[model samples]
Target: MDLADDALRDRARRAGIAPDWTDVTGQARSVAPETLERLLALIGADEPAASVPPLVTGMVRQAIPLPSEAGTGAAVLVLESGERAEITVHPGDDGRCWVPPIDRPGYHRLQLHDREITLAVAPPRCFSLDEVARGGRMWGLAAQIYGLRRPGDGGIGDSRGIAELARAAGRAGADALALSPTHALFTAEPERFGPYSPSSRLFLNPLQADPAALFGQGRVAAAIRTAGVAEAMRRCEAAVLIDWPEAAQAKLALFRALFDGFDAAAEAGGGLAEDFAGFVRAGGALLQDHARFEALQAARLAADPADRDWRRWPAALRDPAGATVAAFAAAQDREIRFHLFLQWLADRAFAAAQAEARSAGLRIGLIADLAVGMDATGSHAWSRPSDVLGGASIGSPPDAFNADGQNWTLAAISPRAMVETGFAPFLDTLRATLRHAGGIRIDHVMGLARLWLVPDGMAPTEGAYLTYPAEDLLRLVALESHRHRA
Candidate 1:
């Protein structure tokens, strides 16, 4: 981020001190585009390797997969930790997790699980090891069948309903079924909307749980539903609104009753529990902790928002130091365990739905969609604040589609940092996304080439294009796409 443009800096200083009543906040002056281009060309040939190496060294782990998109940086890379790097790849034009961080400085001896591999790095650039195949066919469903058509099957469609949909898909000669983002929604809110923007992308939305999917299979008749449970479900589903609160409550209660069934049915060829266990393990302790925080906040808010929210609570309580907050956090943690269990259930349901599509013999099993950004206050931000910049949202300039630019207030990957570090977090996110999905559709696919980065308090017109390493990104994409075969 250093500048060789002395005159530009001088002009900026003058702009800052201008006595003319023009507020410079309205004026963000970098070099003129053409002049900047010329300067870049001139400096590129003459610039010392030392000057450019920092950007490469700044890579979190100094490694990323080669053959990523032709960005200025790595598309994705693997670190020694076997975790992801800050980079991302085009990944077969499908949305799925791509993995990264490579060794930097001299040679790196990597043992992926059991196999030993080696790599070397230079001052500003590093080498990468990529395993890529040409391409392969994929399969999956794109829609959550239950989400559509509010049948008379109470307000919510249970598992039976999903099965019926799967059967229907088979009949229709479709192979796969993709779903809208089914990530859990906040249970407390003014009808928390948008499932894609989740309270926690790692967990499932209990509202989507259909008791009929679990328990109602044997006992309950079609018309007569469980009194308390069904009634809550109806209330949750009745509104024109999404009804996250009523849905959460009804689903949670129904799950409590079904939990016994889940444990008992575990050995009966039902692998949902096991799948969920894998999911929990895959998320690692940090992900679990974040979900626990969501549970705590939701429960305390359920008990009382005034006592729970920082604005109304005592100073220390508002802070993590308050005794009451700790007690509440503990209680909520108990519920978090429940949430984790339910996550397994929902996940099983999701996977089952995918399998159902496969049995139907579709080309793709599940095609998931990834929004470009997430809410700043959400768990993703709370856990990885550095990866996600607050207050600053990701958006785009006005194009032919819409004259007014779009502001996806949700946090986006810090493109520069991500590319340099081989997109570690980005890869993790991709892996989680692609886990169940057979194919992924990255909304605003154009973002991979260049992002219109707008600093806060700036207009869309003032935004500039941040370059990415296109070739490397493409190579990583090819490698990961082969890995997923989508």
Candidate 2:
């Protein structure tokens, strides 16, 4: 049979699935009887060897539903000659592949039939935040936050305001303050309006830096607070309206004032020691590359954002792995230190708030929202192109709220990649998000089963439904939730 022949062409045609087999078996595009036999046994489709999918081997998303009470997330399977990912049980929703960290980059998988295949299992490990079922007396103030604006904040509250709001909410009934994601937004023109959908989850928005708090002394903050205390209060009252840029500018002022403190801390730690060590340990060469990329970005701010690729920058800064790249990396070392300091501070403050909420006899202080994926142009996509959805975007088919359905341009982790990579990054993301929350609200929970992926260059409506190992993915989530009590 022709590998590109559409066996189910009649039905698949309606769903936008074509017989094209261009990307699957790249160079060594030939089927081997041996590997095919192994795969047939794995999927329990060995009835007639002829029935197995021909070694068209491109990107495979093999999802095998593990034996269980069916519909539960649980499974066991090896990749194209890799470690076995087994989920003994399953969880409720999100029975698909686990999510990964935003900073992690690249696709790590073994090639099969000269193609990329994301292996999947039916009995996939999965779970929800409430499944762990642990609770503490904690209450956090959840609010929408923003940064600078062209109209000078234009009534949108900034990070300085957010910190103060956290302080106020803590003083009130809340033990902590959980604001919208403060991930870095695009610095160029036509700023994106959505906060949940961000430009970069790997980095914080500089708009929220609170420059005045950092740069100005007690005098400057006091000046803003005292001069227009009522105005600031009114601004907070009009929450939900976020102006990213202006808020970023105000926060930068505060950040600049307080930067000395960060400097002092780094100095004490001995020359950006902790952050550098942490990045090396966590992200490996990719992390190093990302940090270096950021440094290069800062130096070449003069260029347009679209043309900011280091390769196209100054002659001295062309190659990402060359001398210019090294110099840029060195310059960014300081910024990296500052970024680490900020994250540490944020974590401690949030954790403390959770603790205080617990003390106050509250239940469910911090409920983190886990997005389905990341932004295409953001840090996460840049790092791991393999794990991320390249020619597709995850979205809804047709829902009541959106008759046309919604096309969330956020990037996604390919199911096939997860099974092959042992779901390492995907599993890590779940572990991280749940760690800080009393509970989590997984957006688009249905993503566990099937994702409507709009093929590259196609309109959202032209995508097809791709299924995953719902049971196995969920079971893994349950396993992790149970293990960590998250």
Q: Could you tell me every candidate's TM-score relative to the true structure?
A: 0.63, 0.59
Candidate 2 lDDT, tens digit per residue, 271-354?
A: 344653464466455445544554456555545556643334566654555776676567577775555444443443445544
Clashes of each: 65, 90
Backbone steric clashes in candidate 1, count: 65
Error of 2 at 116 (Å): 22
lDDT of 2 at 34: 33
* Among all candidates shown, the one with the greatest TM-score: 1
lDDT of each: 0.50, 0.48
- Tell me, by lDDT, which candidate is best: 1
